[model samples]
Target: MITKGRVTATLDGDFVVFMIGFRLNKIWAIHKWLPVFLAMPKMLKELNSNKDLGYLHHEIWFGRTLILVQYWRSKEKLLAYAKNKDAQHLPAWKAFNQSIGSEGSVGIWHETYQATRGTYENIYVNMPSFGLGKAGKLQFVGKGQNNAQQRFEKNE
Candidate 1:
């Protein structure tokens, strides 16, 4: 449901923001890009099914350049999940390297960020819980959290 008023979110401690995506360099090369595109859902399902993986939540946008923003409980957990041999990510990564490496038919990239309390602030107006709000604590904007500056100043 849509939240009618301004809302904010806060995580208890440090968090990780992982942005991962692919660009269809050759849109017609379905053979190459399709597999890459298909791999993500499997990984997502794996992560979601196992909370111990430290996967928090994610938001995705699709197009020629797909974008996925993921939240994680910690950087160590994120790296562990990426490198785990038992996970779907490693296999999918290997397949991508073998099938599409340097050919440019599909391009993939990711960036990771470590966030601590007092380092981030967010607000959502007239929207349902989303992004950090979905991954962390969601609440109505309070007296000291009404503005970005104020939110940033919060002691947490």
Candidate 2:
């Protein structure tokens, strides 16, 4: 359901923010890019099916360049998932390297951030729980939590 008022999100401890995506460089090379594109859903399905994998939640946007923002319980869990041989990620990664291999047909990249209390803050107004809000606890923005600086101070 949609939350009608100002709200904020808080996590108990440290968390991980993983941003991963791909850019379709050569649109005509569907053969080279489509496999790369199709691989993500399989991995996402695997992660979603198993909560213990450390995958909390994810938001995806599609276009010429696709962006996926993923929240993880911890950095160790994220790295472990990436390297897990029995998981979908490892096989898909191997396929990407064998097929695409920096040919410029498809450009894939990722950025990982480690966040802790006092290091990150967020506010949502008249919107449904999203992003960090979905990954963490949602609380109505209180008297001292009306602004970014206040949120930071409160979190600190």
Candidate 3:
């Protein structure tokens, strides 16, 4: 079963926590069908392949929009993957940048959190869901009590 996992920020409140959000608009009209046809298989392969390298969690929404919520051991790992030359991600990114750089056909945006206090999360199993799925199944530990309240509470 493909499951989402809780990702907490652990940078002693220094490194920024990113809620990266992005939508990819297909130009090839024919590519409009790629998500259901080709992308799913590619995504499954990537997810399964990188399951061990601190790949915390992810989800696809609105067909073409992919929202990846991952917890990195550190920001360095995240940057490494973003800048990796050999990984499939880099090629995809480059292609997107080249093909849709001017018109915003493909857009990527991110929100960062400098967690001075703390962050908590949960995961939902056996369901097709997004970031909210993380809030469904979670157990809190010492100083990490009140998972519900924590998840619902607004970030500062």
Candidate 4:
């Protein structure tokens, strides 16, 4: 399933930190790969269906490890999908645990934060060799507009 959400807060300047995760079941080593192929189309469909949800950022590392970073307008919208029992997410979570929970064939994890009290900045540079470079710089807002402007200028 496509992990979806919005940015709650910016942290450490570059990190547009939010909560996201997905679950996948283990397939027989021989046939396991088949599910991924079958699932891709469905997953992609769901993602496209929620196009207006938020800014979706994700990366699949080493194939199995899925990482998603997104910015959302509020936590309510994020939680609504997560709590949807009939959605693809709920069934997928069950299947993953049943098939891979024991052998560690499948697993899912997520972290959520309430972003408050910080100024955040980020840069995304796409390079041919590197694909994408991401950075987050954050600091406390102090004094007034003058201080914030100075910090922002320094960062630029």
Candidate 5:
């Protein structure tokens, strides 16, 4: 099991954060939606096994839409992985285009964020490790780091 804490995450410098997920527009169409849902786990497995891919870690939330929060070592690494033919992403993306192009039976989307040291702040009180805390490191949220405002002021 993982330990819980009020610690803040620590990182060397700027890192690329990617939010990627898929939605099932036509939930009844198992043929259309199943492949979309199944493809990610295979891609995730490949990424998890290869450290050079820059996939640090992920947290998933499932509903009508599935959300995956991904942390990468850098933007370049993420792009390289996405474009590499030998890698899982490119093939998946190509297949997605070929199989589900504009049909809207299944939908996929992603958002990206860039974060740097002292530019962002997070606080977790009486909660398990999560988000930035889970993806990066967590420092002790002590006397000076008790609240978000204090954390930002002191951390920056």
Candidate 6:
């Protein structure tokens, strides 16, 4: 059994939050889609095992389109992982380019947010751990911390 309640989260210092995922433009093209799907676990496994790479953690959403929200210690660290030749990401990326060159069988995208302390605020009420909640430190909301603005002030 699970209980639901209020839980808030905020991170410390400068950090990078990355949102990346893909969409299946053509549901019938399993060959094209499966490789893209297969590539993620390899990269995620590599990141999860090596914390120094600044891969903090992630939450994923799956559907016709998939989304992954990832936190990192810094932008430099995140870029390093993306560019490192020895890593799983680089190979998988090259394969993606080769196999699916914008033919529209699949679509992929990403957005990155570079943040510093006090730049973001979040709240989770009657919910499980999620988003910045999973990526940041969790704390119970208290007096004057019941809404968005207060959460920013309380977290700061």
Per-residue lDDT tens digits of candidate 4, residues 93-149? 566566555664444567765443334322222221111122122223334324445
1-156: candidate 6 lDDT, tens digit per residue: 212677787787788989999999999999998999999999999999989899988999999999999999999999999999999998888888999987889999999999876677777877777777777877787788888888777656
Candidate 4 local Cα displacement, residue 42, angstroms: 3.3
TM-score of 5: 0.91
Candidate 2 regions exceeding 4 Å error are none
- The C-alpha lDDT values of all candidates are 0.94, 0.93, 0.47, 0.43, 0.83, 0.87
* Model 3 Cα lDDT, one tens digit per residue, 1-156: 443443322222223344655565554644433332343355446645884443445544554665555444446555676677765566665665665566655557666443333354343444344343342223323353336465434222
Q: Give the runs in model 5 whose Cα sits over 4 Å from its true position.
A: 2-5
lDDT of 1 by residue, 124-151 (tens): 9999889999999888888878788899
User: Which window of ten consecutive residues has the lowest lDDT sum in model 3?
Assistant: 7-16
TM-score of each: 0.98, 0.97, 0.52, 0.50, 0.91, 0.93
The stretch of ten residues in a row with the least summed lDDT in candidate 2 is 95-104
Over 24-50, each residue of candidate 5 has an lDDT whose tens digit, in order, gives: 899898898887888889988998999
Lowest summed-lDDT stretch of 10 residues in model 4?
Answer: 127-136
RMSD (Cα, Å) of candidate 2? 0.8
Q: Tell me the lDDT of model 5 at 18.
A: 94
- Arrange candidates by lDDT, descending: 1, 2, 6, 5, 3, 4
Structural RMSD, model 3: 6.7
lDDT of 2 at 91: 91
Candidate 2: give the clashing pairs: none
